[model samples]
Target chain A: MRSRGAGTRTQLTKLEELLRELRVEEVMTRRLVSVSGDFTMAQVKELLRKHRISGVPVLEGEALVGVVSIEDVTRALEQGEMGAKVRDRMSREVITVFADEPAVEAVKRFAHTKVGRLPVLDRGGKVVGILTPGDPVGRAFRVMDLRYREQEQQRWQQKGLGLEDLLGEGASLVLRFRVQGEDFAGAGKASVQAKRVLGRLGLDPGAVRRATIAAYEAEMNLIIHTRGGELTLEATPHSVVVEAVDKGPGIVDVEQALQPGFSTAPEWVCEMGFGAGMGLNNIQSCADEFEIESEVGRGTRVRAVVHLSQSGRKDRLNR
Target chain B: MRLQDIKVQLEAEQVAGSPRPELEIKEACAADLMSDVLASARPGSLLLTGLTHPQAVRVAALASLAAVVFVQGKEPLRDTLVAAEESGLPLFVTQLSLFESCGRLYQAGLRG
Candidate 1:
C-alpha cells in the first residue's frame, strides 16, 4: 500500500484545503432576505413560500432581532395564532458567524449548533449577509474554477507566437517546462500547454491527443514520485515526442512500475483519484515508441513518441 | 443518442453548465479511478463516476470528455461543480447506482 516515494506531502484533502482558504464573507449570500418584526406570522409564511426558503432573519429597522422559521410558522398556525407578530414567535437567541471568519469555523458551528443557517456579522456587529450550509463550499468551487480558467487563458495568451508560422519543412521545435514536485495543484498544466501548442501546429488530432495524454501521465509521475523534474515536448511534421526527466528517489523496480494497478500511492492520494498504479502503463499505451531509464538512488527518465500517420502528415503538409 | 434523451432516461439533475439538447453522446465509460479514464476513454464520450472531487472534472477536461454524471445521488463538492462550469463541461447527478445507471444507458443504446 506504500509507493516507495509517494505521500510525502501534506495530507489535507482538497475540500479541507479549500475550507481553510475561503472566508465566510466570500461564500455568504449578500442578498438579504428579512421580514420586519411587525410582520404577522401569516405574512412570514407567505414570504418564505414565495422565496422558496425555510427561514429568514427578523429585523427591526436595520437591526437584526431574531429569526423565524417554517417550523415556527407551523406552530403558530396550529395554535390558531397566524396573526401573531413575528417578534413573538421568532427565536431570540441566534447563533451567528462572522464575515471574516474562516469557512471552516462556520462549518464547525453548523455541526455543533445543528442550525440550517447563521447570520453573518461584520466587525461592527452589523449583519452583512446570511451563511447557509451550501454557500461556502459552492462559492469556493466557483472561485477556484474561475482562477483555473483565467490562468489557462493567460498562459495561452502569453505564448502568442504562432508555432505554425515558425516551423518550415525539415524544422522541429522544442518546448520545455519545469514540473514542481508534490505540487498537485499545478499538475496537468504542462500537458494542457503542450496539447494547445500541438493543436495550433496543425498536428493530427489523434497524434496530439496521444502525446498530450502521455505528457500528462509523465508530468504526474514527476509530481508524485520525485523532488521535481522537466517536461519537454519536441514536435516535427511527422511525430511528437514527450520526455520527462526527474532527479532522485527513483523507482526500485521499473518493470513492476509499468504494470497497471501496481501503485505505491498512499491511501489519501488514492482517495483523491490518483496513485492508481496506472500512470506508466497509460503513458506507454499512448505512445508508438516508449522508453524508461532509472537508477534507484539517482533518477528516472521517460520518453514517449507518438508518430503521425501518413494521412496525418499529408494533412499537415497540405495545411 | 442526444444528451437530452440520456438525461431523461437517467432521470438526472443538471447541476452545472448550460444544457445542449442537441449534443450527441454515443459512448460512456464508468470509473472512479482517473487513470483508467485517461487510458481508455474516447474523446466526446460521457463519463460516469462516483468521484466528487474537482480532479474528476479536471480529468474529464483533460480527456476531452463531453460531460460527467455523478451516480448514486452523490453530490459533487461545490468546487467540483464550479470547475465543471468553468471548464464548460456539463455535469449531472443521478439517484441510481453506477450499475443501474450504466444498465439503463446501455439498454437505451449507449455503449461503453
Candidate 2:
C-alpha cells in the first residue's frame, strides 16, 4: 500500500507539472482540414460533413484568412446562399491562438470567445494546426495515463515490502472502532474517520473513494446483521486494509452474499435506504483483494484491501 | 460582457461580490434544478436560477461557474450569502422572471 500511495501521488504531481509545462503545439492537430477561399459554400458544407467537424479554417495559400463554422454554414443555407464562396460565408474577423502559447491559454480563449475551435498559427502567421476543446480534454487524459504508467514502472524497482511489513511498521496508522448492532447512528462513523485520515494522507482520490465505500458497507453489515463487531482500518503509504470481525449470525452462503441484490437485511433496514443486498457485492468490487470466512453458528470475518495505485479502472458508468 | 453590464441590463441587485463588477461573463445558463446545472452548465458560464440556497452556491463552486443570478426576485438565505462570499462567487438577484432574464442576456450576445 505504501508503494501504491507514493506511486499515485508522484504520478499526480507529474501530471500537474506536465500540464503547466505543456504548450498548444504539443496537442493541436497539425493535419488541418482547411478550405480555400474560392471553394463554394456547398463544397465547404460537404467537407465539414465528411470530416464530421463543426468548423474549419479558411486558407488563402499558406495563410489562414478566416474560419467557416457550422453556424455560418447554417445561416448561409437558410438564406439560399449555398452557392456563395467560402470567403463570403466565413468570419474574417477570427480569433486565433499561437501554437507556442501555453495550452492553458487556449482554455481561456475558448471560454472567453465562446468559439468551438481556433486556428493555431506558427511564428510566420501560417495556419499550422487547429485546436478545439476536445484537444485539451483528450491531452490531459493521455498525459496523465502515460505518467501513471511511468510511475508504476518506478514503483516496481522498490517493491521489497509486503503488505504486513508496511502495515506493521512504526509509521503505520491503525484505527479501531466498535460498531454496535442496531446502532444506525454510529454505522458510518468509522468509515467517515477513515476517509478523513486517508484524505489527510493525500491518497489518490479513487483509492480513497474505494476504501471508504468498502468500510461503510462492511460497517453497515456488522450493524444491521451481527450482534456486535470490531472494524479496524490500517493505512500505510501504499495501501489501505480493512478488517471486520463480528460475533455471530455468520453468513450461511458466502457465494450468495457476494452476489448482487443478495441481502439478509430486514424490511426496516431497507426502509432506511440500505440493505438493497449490495453491501457484500459492493465491498468485493471496491476492494482490490477481498476475502470472507464464516462459521454458520459462530462468527464471520471479512478482509478487504484497496491499493492506492493508478491501475484502477474508472468504469463507474457501466455499473 | 461584464457582471456590471448584466446587472444593469437585468436590473439585478448585487447580493455579494458587488465590488468585483468587472468580472467577465461569456455565456449564461438558466435552470432551477441544481442537478441540471451540475450536469449541463459549462465552467465560466453564468448561472441564472431562482433557487437561493447553500447548495446552489456549492454547485456553482463545484462547476466553476462565473456567477449566480437569482431570478424572479428571489433572495438567498444569510448562510447561503455567507457561503458565496467565502467561496468568492458573485451573486445577484433580479426582479425579472427566468424567461425575461435569459432573453435579455441572449439579446446582449450571451450564449447558452
Candidate 3:
C-alpha cells in the first residue's frame, strides 16, 4: 500500500467510499513488528507481554508466516504447551486485502470468512498495514453508520420512495449503519425494530424484507463474534443493497465460512447463545447478489445487491 | 366442531385470544421448537405444545396455523394472546398434557 501520508482527498463516501479511494500505497502501517514461526510458546508468551499487543504477525523472511495471538498463547498455557513453537499455535491460513481496494469490501469477508484482522499488502504483495476491528474510530463508525443507514431507509420510505414508486420504475437509496458487537442479548433486534418501522410506514415488503434478512445477519455477526462493525442498506426502486463491514478479525476462508454447519465458534459461543453457524449462509441465501473482501491483519467487508426488476419473490415474512 | 366447543370440552381457558367462540377446529400437530414448526407445521393445522413465547405466534402466522392449544396446563402471558387475537388465530389453553390433548382430539374425530 502507498503510505496513508500521500493519498488523494475525496468526498466522504461514508467509511466505504473512503476505502474505495484508498490505494495500497496509502494507509499501510509501515513499521513492522513480528515474530518467526519458530518462536517457542514460552518465547511467544513473553513477547506478547513485552509488546503489549494481543497478537503478533508471524514472518518467515519477508513472507507472512502466521499470526500468534494471545488467545493461542492462552490456550497453550492452559495445556501447559511448550517445546512447540509459534507455528504450532499460529494460524497458518491468512486472509489478505489489497491496499488499492475500497474498505467497504471487508464486511462479507469477515462474516463469510470469520477471521479477525486483515493484512493489507502493497502492489508487490508485501505486508503493509493491519486492519483490526478493534480500532476506536472503526468500531464507532460501524455502530453509527448502521444506525444511520437503517434510519435513512426509514426516511426514504417516509418520503414515498417505497414500493409503490419503485416496483414499476427505477429508484435507489444508500444507507449506513454499524452492528454493535458486544451485545449478545440484542441479536436480531435491529431486524425486529426495522420490521416494525416498515410495517407502520407501509413500505415495500420487498425492501423491508431484504433489509431485515441483511440486518439479522449483520447484527448476529457482531453479537456472536463480539466484533463491532457496520451494515448499510441501499435500495433502488428495482432492487435493494446491503453491505456489512467489520474491522474485526478477517475471515479465514470465504468458501468454508459460507458453508452451512461450518462454525469456528467454541462451545461457549453456543452456550452463551451466540452462534448457530447460520450467519454467513443465511446472508448468502437471502441476498440476490453477494461480494466479499478481507486481509489477514486488516479487516473484512461485504457487499450484496438484489435487482428489483429481475428479483424474484424473496418473501422473507414466510421465511 | 368450533374452537370454542373444543375449549369447553377440554376445560380450556382463553388467555389472550378473543376465544373465537365461533372459530372452527381443523387438524392437529405437536411440536415445541420454532424451527420445527416452520419446517413442518401445515396451514389450518391446530397446534398443540408446551412452548410459550411471542415467537410461537410469529411462527404460527408464518405457517398459517389455524389454532394453537397450549397443552399440559401451559398458557401464554397476557400480551402474547393479544398478539394472537390481533392476527385472528384462535388460541386455547388446556390442562391436558400434550399427549392427552392429541388423544382426546383424535377420539373426537379431529383428523391429521
Among incorrect, acceptable, medium and high, the docking class of model 1 is acceptable
lDDT for A281 in candidate 3 is 64
Error of 2 at A265 (Å): 0.6
Highest lDDT among the candidates is held by which one? 1
* Local distance difference test values of all predictions, in order: 0.82, 0.75, 0.62
Sliding window of 10 residues with minimal summed lDDT for model 1 chain A: A310-319
A25-131: candidate 1 lDDT, tens digit per residue = 65776557899889999999999999888899987877789999999999999999999999999999999999888998998999899888899988887888898
- lDDT per residue for candidate 2 within A1-319, as digits (tens), equals 9999998898777655665567777667655799999998899889999989999999899988899999988998899999999888889988998988887788788989989998999888988788898786567656565455446534532453333354554466888999999986445667766765554444554566667667877888899999989998887666789999998988898888888777778897765556677777777877889999998879999999987674332212111
Q: What is the DockQ of each candidate?
A: 0.33, 0.02, 0.02
**Per-residue error (Å), model 3, residue A25:** 70
Better of 1 and 3 by DockQ: 1
Residues A103-214 of candidate 3 have per-residue lDDT tens digits of 5555445667866666777678777666655432343344344446547756764665445454445544455556677664444445555555543344555545555565
Q: Could you give the TM-score of chain B for each candidate, in order?
A: 0.98, 0.95, 0.85
Which scores higher on DockQ, 1 or 2?
Answer: 1
Query: In candidate 2, which residue pairs clash?
Result: A1-A238, A1-A239, A2-A237, A2-A238
**Candidate 3: interface RMSD in Å?**
15.1
C-alpha lDDT (0 to 100) for residue A31 of candidate 3: 38
Winner by DockQ: 1
